[model samples]
Target: MEDQTTQPSPGSSSAAYPRWVLLEMNYKKNDEDEDSSCSTPADVKTLAAARTTSGYPIQVSLRLAEPPAASCVCLQLQVPDDVDVRYPTVVAAHGDSVLIQVTVTNDLGGFWNATTDHFVYNAGAAAAEPPREPSLSMLPPYYITDDYSGPQAHQLHTRATGLIRRGEDELVVAELSLKPARKDSLELKTAELLLFRSGEWILKRPRMSYGDREFGELPLWLHTDTVVPIGDRVLCWVNLVMGLLFCDVFEESPILQYVQLPMDPCYGKPSNRNVCVTDGGGALKFVNIFPRCCCGFVGATGCQRSHGVYVVNTWTLRMSDMEWVKDGMVDATELWALDAYKGLPRIPLSHPVVSIDEPYVICFLMIEDNKACYRDQTVWMLMVDTRSKTIQSVSLDQGERRWYPDTLIPSNVSYYLNSYPTSRSDGTSKSNGQSQIDIERSLVQVRDDDASNSMLQSSCKLSAEPAVQASEILAALQEIPSYGLDRDDMLKAAYRILSHGNGHRFRSLLSLPRNLRKDWLLMEIKASED
Candidate 1:
């Protein structure tokens, strides 16, 4: 492991740097990594190598012994010793555990090859045995639920399930199913839990309890994009487009607690621009990257279109009030004005992931604008600190596969890397257990019967002051001398937005044309810095 005392770059937080890593789930496998010539030893004990004796074909691990600079690490998914290298897809991640899946085949040509040392045919036994036809039964794909205790191999023959480890040998596999309550009606649907525990799988169909909502029914199209085990006995079935459906697997009768995400009017649809992550300190944060402008540029007509710049917003789940408290917001205009952004390419950014160790820090993937597809494009990961309004670090990522934002996740698994049992003290585990219990209890009180209310108000929450009129806003915009936009076109677009009775305080300077917006925006950026 690298020296723990290595200090971070000059402008970053004074706190311990590299507290967490930007984990790339796509494991890089070379030809040498696949040794089909070797067979699994019968008594292999360490997790350092691949194993098939446990019935699973692959194993997952987080390799952080000597981390690359800029707080980045690659998640290692060990391929079966006798099989070809296959990619492991990360389904969900919370804390130190990650849910992943990898396909496997029954073809064992490597085991039957005569060159292998273990390939020995008994002449006497072969003569008595009848010719056996090649079997067509392929082994089921492996779904791995890795825990902090270490990766354990389990053969789960199903999909859409997340595992939570309770102890060395105890684990729970929870799957969420949402379907119509009856075959006759498609509108009335029910959510059910399928749990695997104590060596048996049981389906729990609890009574449906609706939470506070204007619409008193489940989303007709609530597509579960991912499943996350949030801690304690609670797991969240998330729909990035809509909201999160949380359930406590330990309950005698588990109930779903629904929490709606703050809606962004610009997109109005779901995309990979948003992500949900947990702080190692036991807090759930939802980070969103608005591909449009959100600062003082609300009146700009073309801001909603893809201009390659964006605004990043973060909200923390106040488990107390069941409300999402807005944590922070940073606009690209402000970032571009800083010296840190000058050296970096002006590529488009996607995949907003918040750090597990430092909630204020966010990581993004930048891709060139000319690349039609991400297949072979060069990608860079940038870590930005919202509180300090500075770039923490930037690193080039070179992997041999297609890249996407979902392929990267924020995890604290590195914290456990070389510090497995022998290096860690007993007190560390006790403190972690206590912290987990505290976070788990935060979800215990979230009941479904609570009065349904609007979880997120409009982006611009109007105040009690008298409403501002369109004419007044237009008058202010007309005063900007360097405006390149035509007077009629600008007035029409500004009026179209402010015609609504809601009092939206429009900034005339921010509504300038692209060429003019930068000049005025930089002035305001410098003013704030002063």
Candidate 2:
């Protein structure tokens, strides 16, 4: 419909090198297969079916335009709304260029929505990001062999060293082919990742890993010995390789400031894995949630016998010293652990979600059937405030929500505010006590009156209020009469008002009854999720 090229904004340096232009509205695989029918202005069309997930082929194609001279051109494959897509891959022709590859990368596995789809191909442009020095370890492979085409390929060896760039992160991978190096005794490799700072190799992680060459296990794991550069400092995740899985992170400074994830009563064994190390905003977030299940002992007397879990732990990497740039969790970071309280049967937590607008984690609760040891399965919204360490459970009866059989999760307001401006958790640190009072006063429900508007103008900040006073705001929101509407309808009204900056809340959630379909009377934000 309209052009949506990955162009810099008007205020940006208009001198963007190797500009992209739209020449045609579609991509045609052959003379007969001509279909120009994608919505975005990039005008992407079906190239080839690389792989299929949920019966949807991962198709790969290019925009009908010249490649950027400064970088490799990567584009997002805009799947049509009518497609039953799942985890898919890109396809290439029999003799096509060997560059096409499939990527299914989401911290919570792969699921892209209509608004926040991440299908942009990274054409390996160092200038695209703020920092200049690129992840310089991606290289092509060189074959060291004779008659490598036939089944005698085992006689040949291959070696390579190069950089691989995912969306915002990069990795320097190195590989080598050896001459009968005895596939039994492991080949040990040791090296160090050095960051070339103002001309010095600031030492990072020392590379050390044993390659199980017999089974083709890599000698060095990718993240075990790695250095990722955040803002001014580098976040280093180093496996000490000292018989234990304990890793040390040297943050900001290599000599002084550092934190070690130690072993304890539960995670003392190296076997307890570090599931992920996320750049939470910039807080250097790490997860160690390992959940396992086992069959019960013969004739054992336990409540958790029928369940598939015992305990779960989720730790947030909080910054103790705040002198440096302290960034933490962003929106939608998932924390998955089947941690049903011990001896109380399994909780089987589902739809786990880290908050976007708040510093809390919320999930829907599940209960064991016909169990008497613990019967508070009526708890609906299990919320854990990471900052306050407060675990508050909102029972189904608390909201009188038990009568509504159609209700799934206690509909929350955060989902609708994903696109709306939210106060950052860090914004609270910037405000004084008076500013806090100003925030609370401005949050009273916007009444439809000049006197109320004048009162709000005197108390409210000229700009947006920080998220420091979210609890007060939620209280204020609750005081407003729901009038038979749920949180979903309230959020829809809030979205409409914020988007258009007009209309009353209740009326905003409603439209003139559709002539054909009265079901459209109320707006549905997440139809599928509901």
Candidate 3:
């Protein structure tokens, strides 16, 4: 296994520092579309801007689990100007490199899409350091959909892709696809691997080797849930319902090795509700949350609804012997009894993630009961320490501003933020490995002054207000729906209309007949369209 980036020293000045951070998968959207005439920097304004892609800008934010959510640091990715539809995913993260999978489509008519991977090295280096260009020389764009009848119809193929960084400059991109292996059975498809490295792409069909396992117990088919880079050139494709398929891509005669997972307690039930395979230290940690009924019996028949209680179980895999060791389990009742648990509701949690830094500590999200109406309600993140049997911390998840399905990825990127390459007078650049003492001292000073943390605030809040005249009542009415406070009269009018039952204002917008305000809003919409 490669040596991952080290966390801050315990003697550092910045008390209560973080190790691994929770990365927001979806890109952060800037307010450049609100007014195009602003004087923001060309690089900042053009990043993920609609002018380049006709879609929302792309940026990712990092937040400490223990701190308030407002202390997030947003990062803008370097996007090329030729793409139309931009979809980015953090495929792999190790040391100081973050591999981003950019699924782009230059087709304005939305007929096709392709993949371009970006490697961000030394991601959180100092702003004063020179910019390092990422390696993005990839194959030509191809269609993701097979139904496309365009000129590039021959390039239509869909497959699951993953990335792994071998050393400093060497990287590997792997694509997995299944082809039918006869017998008129869809479950008998053969696995094939397409590898890209050293400026060349190779397509090979590897043999599937199952050791000490009965063929009857094998999974009917392989459905990859997620791909994990299990160091030493080994990449794992995990299926929550089935097992894991590990393959060493660099081997001359690589083989897809199979390892069956432990007996799932939630099997025959809703097993997919809360399950995750996370990296713990250098081993693989599997987390599964079992919904326990109030009257026992694993939330089965003769019990109440499976809503509130749950049990979180964790297991660590010792790679040497390919064995899973049961770590520990924590019940929801033990957490609710703690004082810190009072801050969070006693609701069933979703998206249970095991902390990579502290394997005993688990992070979960408490969303609304109604899955469809979850966007309208508040989302909370809970950090529970199973070893100590205490709730570590809870923070409000800014759900409305962020896109959904943004899986929480725990990475050591936070440890590299303070480590950057220092240049000498002769133009020689080298990393100061032990300069974290100075970095922690500077961070302590920044945290002392609240005003110095403006970068942590929301991008929309930092945007300058557009020029609005008080006499422009139409503009005021138009901005009311946005809930902007640029015009005081318009804000008060809208509030009066919304809060009509307060009985404070006699002549409110609602009291002036509902049709009158509706007609004015319709006219504003029509005029804006014109």
> TM-score for model 3?
0.60
Assess each prediction's global lDDT (C-alpha) against the native. Answer: 0.46, 0.26, 0.48
The digit string of per-residue lDDT tens for model 3 on 1-530 reads: 11112233345332222445665555444455322211122222112111112233444333333421322333344444654334445555554455554444655464656544343333333222553322222233322344556443122122256566655567676767766676577677687787766655677777786875423223365666566666548778777767777888898767888877776575332232333334333557677776666544354343444456666666566566676655555556656666677767776666666655444567777765446764466777777765445677788855535445345555555543433433422243432221212111211110111211122222112222233222233333443332223333323443333323332121222222232333232222222222
Residue-level lDDT of model 2, residues 75-138, one tens digit each, is: 2333444432222112110001112222222232366422111121222232333412111111
Q: In model 3, which runs have C-alpha deviations exceeding 4 angstroms?
A: 1-18, 26-83, 103-159, 212-219, 267-281, 300-307, 369-374, 420-530
Q: List the residue pairs that clash in candidate 3.
A: 28-59, 48-57
Q: What is the C-alpha RMSD of each candidate to the true structure, in Å?
A: 15.7, 20.6, 22.5
Q: Estimate each model's TM-score.
A: 0.59, 0.30, 0.60
Better of 1 and 3 by TM-score: 3
Ranking by TM-score: 3, 1, 2
Best by lDDT: 3
Candidate 3 lDDT score at position 465: 20
On TM-score, the candidate that comes out on top is: 3
Candidate 3, after superposition: displacement of residue 317 in Å? Answer: 1.7
Candidate 3 residue 524 C-alpha distance from true site, Å? 65
